[model samples]
Target chain A: MLTVKKASRLFKDGAAGFKNITFTVQKGEIVGILGTSGCGKSTLLRVLSGLDHADSGTIHLNDGSPSGAGVIFQEPRLMPWLSVEDNVLFGFKNPSKYRKQAAHYLSLVGLSEFAGALPRDLSGGMAQRTAIARALASQPSVLLLDEPFSALDAFTKMQLQDLLLDIWQEEKTTMVMVTHDIDEALHVCDRVIVLSGQPGEIAAEFKISQPKPRSRSDLSLATYKEKIFSILEYSNTGLQKYSVR
Target chain B: MKSKLNLIGLGMILPVLLIAIWEAAARLGWIESYLLPAPTVVIESIIEMAQEGTLWAHVSITLYRVGAGFLIGTAAAVFIGAAVGYFKKAEHLLDPILQAFRSIPSLAWVPLFLLWMGIGEPSKVTLIAVGVFFPVYLNIVSGIQGVDRKLIEVGKVYHFNSLQLVRRIILPASLPSFLVGIRSGLGLGWMFVVAAELLGASEGLGYLLVLGQNTSSPELIIASIILFAALGKGTDALLKSIESRSLKWQDNLQNAQ
Candidate 1:
């Protein structure tokens, strides 16, 4: 439900964050923007979420409005002074009316018992889950997540990926996630877009037709994983090494 | 609970021991009684003042002056601090002047204020306000400016207006520093009162100190000193309770231990 055309951004010192990038996301799709460090993936997400403006080109929502997008950063970014429940209801104009909905979302992220706890008291995984609940509380049409699980342990990361899929199925909200992990992108996304180069542009795109609850060890998924790795390696070597086993 | 009581008892041991030593020294003729009054003598002076109703009257007047000057000073400081913090132009215009004033000791202002406003209630109150103003103002400005930029980004993503950002993020984030400012301001307030009353007043604990020296009564001077110490401790304890309650979300100090 979102379209970004020829979007480009530059730093104040004239270095490119991203240049001439173009992409579109369909309704109810889970898209992963995968790249290595310094690939401008987070910057792209910021542009998409309207927190920062693109230096050139345009971004348009199909419905012609920009009000309904929720963003979660790598850090939970919860107001430490506010309790978990109040944080979830932070942006709501009528918090009392949405109290039930906030509780529901918190329960969805398995933080029902932690509603009164401050952000400092929560574990890393629990704080990230609370952030997820907060984003979902607004019931936005689009949710943008920027390396949200990077700091979490592997077990917690897997659990959050599964939780995210469950929420996606239930809410059917479009999600755009930025990640550096290959398996994580393959595990959670419907489509993966790889970005490369100093001034990043979309290097390649892949569609996964795998069904829900896809197993990581599945034989068929290996080929897709291998293909993605070769594409990444080729991009890294400037297409000098094309061999793929 | 028992451990807490034990801790308090441990704290009292040194003070009690010192008082006992002083009393013994005075009674046994180990020290001159005229220079340092015995504990019993100070207690008798306190009782005498209580009976004559002078103790409560002096206390009330001192409390009134401190309360008025502290409230006025703190309110103005917070306002100016917010303004300077939010606007670069205000900072440029006001910070230099504030820095210059801050370098001058609170006692140094006593003479200038007396000359300007005369040795009345006005000069005394003005001196106390000057002492209270600097710490609170500096802390508030630095606190506001130091708020994390990442948090401000969150506000932008949520579409919060400038007013909402200030109320929700800036003020609460700066609260710890603001509270610190208030505590220090109160301490300086007490010091300024004593300096003000040293010259101008006919009442207050400070006036009693000078009166004791003039009349050669060590008991009155010691009693006044004790009152000042008690009042400072009591107010600081009150502020500490407020700091802990308001910043309950901070687990850093507890977790560190």
Candidate 2:
């Protein structure tokens, strides 16, 4: 479980990106944060993952601190110099026991055959899968993804999405995925939060009220996708214009 | 198989062509037999030197100096480079002075070294050590710096402390550079060894070169030059084999799956 109370990230005492933002993501629930390109979606994810700190707010997370939270960037960020297995096992301090776990994750991502392959050899989708594998290898309690699959083709993206849903279901980990794709949000997330405009704050939150393993072709998902797009359109048109320097 | 023969053809053609031209020139008096002896004359001089066993004596002394100077110089370079690359304080303090010193050629230190240490093995070794230093240092520094920042971020995320960062990340990243430096240092060692020997040493290939000048034979000088060139090439080949083996992981990571 995670709770954010008035979370505002002000970089350099200038304009705050996220302002008075308050929301709670239930344990084992995948929440998608949808927003415009310049909105604080990635920044929010970074803050949650402890890569960047919240300027002011109480971010209450499970266990000790947010430092242990696993993070996957937009890029695969796998070390090009290491093999696929080695890259997967990078976070594992105990390679003897955890090396098998790396292999397991490699198989989990259907990359068991390419365990010897380097990052450069991987396709965009495959490399992102490896990045996902690397994140899961840490056995994270809370996984934060920052537009992690924006680079993939539609087919590979769907496959990875299914893989992620399977992992999330099995592990029951708290997942916060930031994405611009509304269909993706409706497909995987238990709740969808829309952040509005530049220097964004949470404008609307929607609980899917739908059951697990939701299908995109489902009528409910199609309706939710329309609702999400309209919510974004309304938020953008309604947002107050202010000069940001 | 056909391409292999072409490699062989290219190799055989150049030397055979050079030797034939050299033999012709000596016979035609286009080049003096004494000043620039034919290849055969140099071979005969090598036979004579072998008969007397004096060739090995000179060769042994040169090898000893080269080995001693190389080891000392390479060790210093690797250590100093790692220190400068890893520590901010060390870099700020040592870099400028090292840079100033590096600007002076290794041979430039010979006069000062000889004045201080005399025309002994110490001065000779000192010259070679200084020569070997900068290439290793610069290569190591650049290699460590060249390590992809993203790779370091992986370490940072894992909470690798400073010591572990150097051991797991910096050292491995800098090793290829360090090895290249050592190989090039060995090359520089030959220059210092022979130059020092030419100036003062009683034995060695360079001593033979100077001796030929005294006797005005040129054949013994040519033989010494060939011996030195062959030694340099052989050592380089040996280092290349070691480099290729040691960096196999990197090669696989880069080229293959």
Candidate 3:
């Protein structure tokens, strides 16, 4: 489990980052942080991932280990010189000890054939899959994803979303993802927390009780999409009373 | 691979053509042989030197100086450049003075080095080392500083310590630049060796140039110049091959070609 209390990380006149945010993620739960651009979604994730320090609050991880969480950035960020398998094992203190697990992780992401190939040889989707394998190989208590699939084409994004769900079903790792894609947030997350405005604060939170293997075009998701759209519109328009009815 | 051979053949065409023209003109007595020797006459002079066994001694000694100087210079550059590149404090402390030293022509050190160390092997080698040092050092510093920040963040997420970060990320990330530095350094090393030999030497190709001048043998001078050209190109080609092999992972236009 992870908990953040009254966390504020602001920059440049105190209006460019997240402010006073409080949230908790339970074990094996998938939580999504959704927002429009410039709403400090990434800043909140950075604070949670401990890449950046919060100016006003504390983040507590259950294990109290600095390596307790693994992060997948928007870009694959693979070491070009490393082979796919070596990249999977890159996070381990002693890579040779976990050498066998690298194969498993690569297979999980369907990159078993590419284990010996350099990152330069891989396509964008393949590279991102290799990144997923790398994060999973660490076997961290919590996985933090910062728009991991945003750079992919629509088909690859949907495939990766399903792949993510499959991994969740198997490993049950706690995940906290930051995304701007409303449909994606609704699809894979157990709960989506919406942040709005400059120096972003939580505007609303929606809990989806739907089980796994839900259809992408389900009527239920469409209704939820409508609500999230209006909420995002309201926040983005900001007090200019315009009828979007 | 076949294309590479063709490329080599393509490069030799102009030089061969020019040599043929000069040889033809010399045979027809179209020019003064004393002023400019024919390519064959230069080749004959080189063969005569080789027959006397003096050519081997000169070539070997010059090779030794260049090799020793290159290694020493590169080792020092790696040490100092890594420190300057990694530590902000080190950069602030050392970079200004190093930059100032860099701007001075390396040849400017020749007279002072002779004065300090005497007109001996030490002075010659040290001058060559100084010439080799700057390119390698500057390249390393820039290479380390230019590493992608996003890659460093990945290391941080894994909780890598400073040393681990450098070993796992920084060193490998900057390797291409390091190789580039050494190639240019080797070039400067070749140039400085000639300067070193020209100033004070009993042997070597540069000494042969001086010998030819004193004896008024235009063929000998031409032969020594040819040897210098061959040696410089040969060493550069060796370094280039090493560079290409190590940097096979790069996604660049050269690889596409």
- All models, RMSD in angstroms: 3.0, 3.4, 2.4
Give all candidates' CA lDDT scores. 0.87, 0.83, 0.91
**What TM-score does each of the candidates earn?**
0.95, 0.87, 0.96
Candidate that beats the other on TM-score, 1 or 3, i.e. the better one: 3
Clashing pairs in 2: none
DockQ of 2: 0.34
Listed per model, the TM-scores of chain A against the true chain A are 0.92, 0.91, 0.95
On residues B48-69, what C-alpha lDDT tens digit does candidate 1 reach at each position? 9999999998888788778788
| Candidate 2, A167-222: lDDT as tens digits | 87777878999999888888888899998865788878889988878766889677
lDDT of 1 by residue, A1-245 (tens): 88999998877454447778888999999999988766678899999988899999999877533457888889998889999999998877667788899889999999999999999989999999999998888777789999999999999999999999999888887999999988988888989998876467898898988987688787877887888787677666763353341
**2 versus 3: better DockQ goes to:** 3
lDDT of 1 at A162: 92
Ordering by lDDT: 3, 1, 2
Best by lDDT: 3
What is the model-wide C-alpha lDDT for candidate 3? 0.91
lDDT of 3 by residue, B53-162 (tens): 99999999899899999999999999999999999999999999999999999999989999999988999899989999999999999999999999999999888999
How many steric overlaps does candidate 2 have? 0
